[model samples]
Target: MNKWLQVSFVILTFALSGQAYTDDSKVSLPDDSIYHLDSEWVTQDEQTINIQSLSGKQQMVSLIYTHCMHTCPTIVATMQNIEKKLPQDVLDNTEFVLVSLTPASDTAKVLKDFAEKRKLNQDRWTLLTGDPQDIRSLAMALNIRYKKSDDNEVAHSNVFTLLDEQGRIVFQEVGDINKVDETVARIVSQ
Candidate 1:
């Protein structure tokens, strides 16, 4: 009876601790935080989440569509390379976001297939597609520009943005991705 009572007490304590940790007692976000945007996004695995849900960890974000035959692939490769250069602790706490510039075509299923083919680590990488307007809003917020051509191709800016836990921009790399690893490590260490 004593052992059973102790075990029950331990379980209840853990349950309460978890609930408290997840409670809605978060501090208010600043005016410029990207998380303040009311946009709904679907992940590669078809889970429906939002920008705010991505708030806790540092976010390294890029814009790409899976079907692109040009710089988009390079962008993905660059993100993977950045992941390799991070220290284990920073890598574990950081999340990579790839937002589809062609959201009208890059459905959740398509994103999932792309992720599988590329062997992207689902635990650390998020491939997202959402309504076109939402994608545009996020792109504008991050200072990434895009225009769709008649050939079904998108001419887009090559920008990689880093957002801190509260969704404020820590750094943004434009065109040249070679510096991301070093910048990320330095900012995170500081």
Candidate 2:
């Protein structure tokens, strides 16, 4: 009877452990993950990269145009402020992505120049430009609305999108560019 009890306990332990391992191995991204979008982008260095290529890292994304005289600069400054407040570890794991609304004018060289003028960190920041249709598709996926005016300036709303390591949008802040403390707290806690 004692030997039989020992064997049963061993079998039960093995069965439970096997089930747990299977569950852990089957972890998957949610259906609505933004990584599912099939948008390709050209980096400031002229390298072409797909949105999924940004997977495995947390990302903060914004839409902007280089020619804007008002809101774009403020948006960039807000991003810079957020970066400054993040802890070193969080900063290391995060990527700041700026997608150009004026893809026709904001070529790789233009994007690179804008980054340099702003003194954005080359390693942590990525500025992208691509086909106008592709850019519009990405904007739609993120729910960002924008349109070019008769004067060629982009009329758009201000939104900062925060994506998790899997590219799922975990948080988003609209308007009030300076109200980022909650966003910072979310990043730190995650």
| Best model number under lDDT | 2
Clash pairs (backbone) in predicted model 1: none
Question: Can you tell me which runs of candidate 1 are displaced by over 4 Å?
Answer: 1-27, 175-177
- Tens digit of per-residue lDDT, candidate 2, span 20-56: 3333212465667776665789999999998888878
Model 2, CA-based lDDT: 0.85
lDDT, model 2, position 149: 83
Candidate 1: RMSD to truth = 8.8
